[model samples]
Target chain A: MAVVLEVEGLKKKYGSLEALKGISFKVEEGEIFGLIGPNGAGKTTTLRIIATLLTPSDGKVTFLGFDLKKHPEKFREKISYLPEEAGAYRNMKGIDYLNFMAKFYAKDEAEVREFVERAKRICGLGERLKDKVGTYSKGMTRKLLLARALMTKPALAILDEPTSGLDVINSLEVREMIKGFTREGVSVLLSSHNMLEVEFLSDRVALIDRGEILDSGTPQGLKEKYQASNLEIVFRSAVQ
Target chain B: MKNFSHLLIKEIKELVNKQLVISLVFMLFIFNFIGNVTKSEIKKAMAKQKIAVLDLDKSEISKNIIGALNMANFIIEEKSGEKEQVVKELRSSGLDLLVVIPAGFGQEVSNFRPGEVETYSYLKGISMTGSRKSEIVKALLQTTNEFLSNEYLKKKLPDLDPKLLKAPIKSREFVVVRDRMAEGSTSAVIGSLYAQSFILPVILMMIIMYSSQMVITAIAMEKQNKTLETLLTVPISRTAVVMAKMLAAGIVGLLSAAIYMYGFRNAFSFNTGDIAKAMSGVAPILKQLGLTITTQGYALFGISLFLTILVALSLATILGVLAEDYRTAQSLTVPLVFLVLVPYFVSLFADINTMSLPAKILVLAIPFSHPFFAVQNIMFGHLNMLWLGIVYNFLFVVVMLYWTTKIFSTDRVLTMKLKWGKRKVVL
Candidate 1:
């Protein structure tokens, strides 16, 4: 399979504290790859660096034949990044917000309309999309943001917590949607701390602790390698 | 460029929302309400004032004094009661003032000695109208003194012209601006010019203050909402992003300034109209003195004003990136607010032309000072100085925009931290 993203020796520092210490990962085409860890395990830092929101202090990210440092705009052209708990313009209707964001990616007005129409159907807010985004519930906002990320249909999508802050039902719906998107030849690099959820979702899973990836393989492969039942026990056994 | 336009349109829509429109309408209504109340108060102050008079002399000069006071818009009511009693009962009896003409007062005036007229004024609360009423009474009394003195002079100098005897010297004042001169006092010409063009500086200040604040708030809200991270990763030129935000903020700032100017004009329309009418006789003199702004001068001033506003907006954009949330945005704007306030107050209280060298340099160093000095610069044809100001403002804006774009391009936009305390990051 063609690789969609490559990260090598990625190191990020905030002030004097090292956040990510030489962590490496790769995302291949048409696969759901998850970086699983605790709250302060550098998952967000790694995702942000690849999304071009932060510069890696000591390494490189190559995406779609473009170096992130040298050609960030080029990297941006083929990817969509959905931050954890991201928000839309509060004063705009959900449909209008989608339209506004769609223009930045679309080549013409027709493409913008197509993107927004896809977003409307994917979000499933229906008449609720006519109301201002400020009035949306947390689950509704997360769903809308998920729909926005997929509507662009980019070559790669960097999702930081794709189902963050959603209820059980909403979480299931979002997981199904993300699974559906990967079937369309779009690769994904998502980060989360929900081990069970990630084990159920990612085709390949990486167990990260502090700032380093301790082990990485398919969920079943890691579980078998560590002689554990689930990916969570595998992570505990790998840490030990 | 197309994405830039889309961002600009989105920014404007976000700024001019339903809540903002409703707030602006409410503000205008309050302004108009206050304006009408002030007009009624001013009219009451200008109406005829009632005064009580106690005449002990019962002489012809006393009668003449009372008649003169009555003719000068005072409704005189004679009182024969005790002096202290009449004075105490002045305002409670619908009188604003009390005058006592003592016995033999007319004899002293008849013998060419100045006689004193005792006056007691009722106390009123400290307000503009209250002071205006007091000033009217005070002015009428001075005029009456002049009349009495002229009468005495006529009687004393029977063979000579009393008018010429009273003023030994006659002089005419003329004001000059560059080579052009007009037959008027310099102060009068300056006053007329200020009266007509003060609104420009006021509007400039309002636009800068309102617009910069709006930018900071917008950036802060984006941060608070956690939307900035997603926004920065989008496929658009970062420089274009900065430009779109600045331009949208500039447009909204102008809109806010327009609404504020409308409210301000409505509040002071009566006073401004009165001043224009009072200075009507000096209109030709003002023109001769070159105190008016020409078309070319106005165009130049407008450019300078635009550049200054851009400079403010650019600085504001940089400051806004440092803000952590909506609550932190207000304190972050303090520095920019101080920059605007310095020029505004200095231009109001001191003349930049006549200021000391150090003070003048300091004032002109502020980019906003250029528009505040526009009136004097246009009047004196200080085209070189004005052009220098234009260049300075342009360079200032460029430097600020470059710095802002640099921040946006780098990881500084994400990791930049600002804190009120040494160890805590507040914004």
Candidate 2:
């Protein structure tokens, strides 16, 4: 598979603290790659850098062979990023939010309507599309955000803590949606603290700790390498 | 290009969703209505004065004086009782003024000696209200003196030329600038009063209330919603986001200003003829004060106001970045309002040329002050000061924009922590 994203020697510092320390990674097309870590493991920071949200102190990132610094607009056009605990304008209805997202892709009104309909069905929004987002539950808002991210049908989707606040059912639904993306030859780079989510959705996993990747492989491969039966034990052993 | 268009659409959508546009329109309607109503009341009150006449002489000359006063717009009320009743009324504030003609006034005047007419009013007892009434009475007496002199010359010197009796020292009052003279009509006075007491305050209120809160809340909202991070991830430059926000704010500010001005004009039943005449004289004065507004002065005024608002909004954005929430953003507006009001108060109390050096410096430093000063200069025909005001206002806007953009571009604005009084630190 073609490499959809590449990062080299990524380093970021905030005052006296180093959030990212010369970290590097690659995400291939048609793969669900998860960066799993603890609460302060810099998973979100890494994802932010990959999404072009933060400028790395010393590093280079290229998305689909386009340098982030040189062609950020082009890279943004090809990818959709959902930050951790992402929020939508609460006063706008779900469908309006969807249409608003679709506008970034230059989709006509008719195209937006059709796209929102498809996204709504896939996200199981149903009649809730007419209600203001402020009235939505945490899981519902997450679903709405996921639906909006998918509406553009970009080649690469970057999701940070995509199901952090979701219920089990919504989490499973999100997992299914992410799986659907891989089936359609689209790439995904997801960061999460949920080991179970990582084991279930990611075809490949990178266990990161303190801004550095401790280990990288398939979930089962990481478990086998650490001589553990589960990815959780592998993560614990790797961190130690 | 497509993404920029999308960004603009999303901004407009968010602005609409916030219901700011609707609220501003409503505010404009209500404020304008109140301003116009107040203006009309003031105009009606100033139209004419009521005067009390005490004809102690009961002579034809005194009667003729009373007749002339009655013919002129004064509501003349004759006191039938004694001098005590008239004096009591004047002191009690029941009468604006008392015109007391002495018993021998007609015989003395016919003998060619100066006839005395006494006017009485309680000056020190009452406040401005009583004082203004006394001043008006004094002015009427001066007019009466002039009329008496003219009448005496006409009657006694029938064979002599009337022009020869005219004073040797003839004074011709030529206004330095004539444009403002045309606005001397009733409507012009009303319009100017409205512009001062109503239009200026409303404009300041709208600019401070909306621009300060809106700009700050917009930035803080993005931060709270975590959308700032998402937007930062986009390929667009960070400066682009700031520019987009400023542009959005400018649009909102201009829209609110237009709505307020429109409502003001419509609600007041503006007399266009008076405004035109007033504006003509006002134009040259405005030019002198550093503002050159032509027949199309309204357009220029609108543009200057828009630019001034944009500068204010940009400053608000910078202040907003320092705020962590909507409430903090709102509290920040108080100082902003004080800053805007300083210039207005200075313009009100001090003349353009005679303003204290510090006041002049402060006014020159503030963009909004120039507009206030320029508007007055234009209306009053102070041409020399108008250009200086316009240039200073323009420069202030430009400098503010540059500084605000710099502050926005720096990461310090986004990450800086705010410290509260003594106990807590707010982000």
Candidate 3:
């Protein structure tokens, strides 16, 4: 397998506080790479840097052989990012919202329509897709947003806390959708606090805490390395 | 640039969602309707005056004077009740004036004595009608004096022409500006010109203020909802995003300007008609001296006005993105609003041509003040000043756009927060 993204010596600072300190990671082609950490553990900061939403204070990031800093627009063209608390324009219907976003990625009306159709099918909102997003339930909105992120079929999907603030059922559904991405040979870099989710969806995982990556390996490998039964236990032992 | 239209459409849809278009239409409709109603009432007031005349002389001269008054605005009601009764009715019936023609008044006029006509005018404390009624009294006295003068002059020179005795000399009034006699009412011409000078700036200020708020609210909403992050991550350049937002705001601002101008034109249309006719006669002379506004002048004004709005939108978008939510964003707009208002108020009284050096410098220093001068310059045909204003506004927009685009292209756009007192919040 080829590496789709490489991050070396990625560092970020917010005034005196270092959000990400010299973290390095990579995602292989068609692999689900998860960064598992606690709140404020720099998982989001790292993912944002990868998404090209933020510039690292000091780092070198290469996505598909393109220098992220020098060619961010080129990098951005091949990736889709979903923030933790992503929201739609409340006034727009779910279908309209998808179409609006689709226009940014698709080449023509036909492609935009095709993307919308695929997103609608993924969301499975049916009649609810025509309703304004402001009227949709939280779960429905999250599903729609996830569907939007997936519809573009980007080379890499950067999801920061994809299932944050979701119900158990919604979280499970999101995890399933992320798993489906791997089957399609799409690369994913996901960050989460839920060890179970990271273990379930990620082919390989990095245990990060306080802006540093403590460990990185296959989920089973990390569990075995920590002499733990599950990833929760592995995460606890790795952070300690 | 590929996603610019998409982003622009999204902004326009949001503005529609906010009911901005509907609100403007409703405002225009209601304002014009009210204006028409007020104009009709003013016409009615100007058409006539109601008065009660108490004629104690009971002579031919008194009766003739009453007849002359009746030919004009006076609706004469003969005094039959007591003075208190008439006075009481005066307040209720809206009678404008009460005339008490004293006894022996005709005999005193025959004896060449100055006979007094005591007039009691009922004036509402805050009403504009008081001065109008005073003018009516002055006219009435002048007419009565003329009748008395004609009687005296006829007897003094029975063979002479009455018109010649009435007016020994004929004089025609002309307004002299820079040693040239100018036609048209100086009051009306100057009044309308100054009126435009005052109102255009205020209108531009309001449009910029309102449209900037709309832009800020839109940007702040995207920031709060985290949608802007998703937007920036798209393939489009950051410059496209900033430009699209500014364009959308300018569109809304222009629409608002159109609505406001319609309302303003309608509200003042009745007054401007008379002024326009007065101005039309002298317009050629005014234009010869480059004192009248031309089509190009309006075009230039429009350009500078639009540029000023762009500058405002740029500032608003930056501040809005720097704010975490609407409350913070609105609070951030206060200083900008104050800056705009300072120019608006100053332009009302301060003439830039005669302004003190410090005051002129202060006015020129605030970029918001330039639009006010743009109006005055075009109307007065100060092309040099107008050109200077356009350049300054263009540079202002360029610098601000550069700053806004730089902000948009950075991580700071996502992390920037305003710090107040001991607390700091991400915008």
The DockQ scores of all candidates, in the order shown, are 0.81, 0.43, 0.83
TM-score of each: 0.94, 0.76, 0.91
Cα lDDT tens digits, model 1, A123-231, are: 8999999999999999889888888888989889888988888889999988988888899998988999999889988999899999999999999999889889998
Clashes of each: 0, 25, 3
Look at candidate 3 and tell me the lDDT of residue B153. 75
For candidate 2, the share of real interface contacts preserved is: 0.58
**What ranking of all candidate models by TM-score puts the best one first?**
1, 3, 2
The residue ranges of model 1 lying beyond 4 angstroms of the native Cα positions read: B127-130, B270-279, B423-427
Over 4 Å off, model 2: A106-114, A227-231, B32-69, B72-138, B145-168, B172-217, B234-240, B266-271, B277-316, B332-427
Model 1, B1-427: lDDT tens per residue?
Answer: 7888888887788778787789889989999998898878878777876777899888898888888788877778899977877777775766666778998988998887888788776766655655665576677668777887888877777788777887879989988778987788777777777777667668878999989988888788888888888888889888988888888888988898899889988987735677779689788998887777789988999899989988888888887888888777889888887888888888777778888899888989989889888767887888888999999999998899889999998888876768767746432
Candidate order (lDDT): 1, 3, 2
* Model 3 interface root-mean-square deviation: 1.0
Between prediction 1 and prediction 2, which has the larger lDDT?
1
Task: Pick the lDDT winner.
Answer: 1
lDDT (CA) per prediction: 0.85, 0.72, 0.82
List the lowest-lDDT window of 10 residues for candidate 2 chain B: B174-183
All candidates: CA RMSD in angstroms? 2.4, 6.2, 3.3
Please say which candidate is ahead in TM-score: 1 or 3. Answer: 1
**What's model 3's overall lDDT?**
0.82
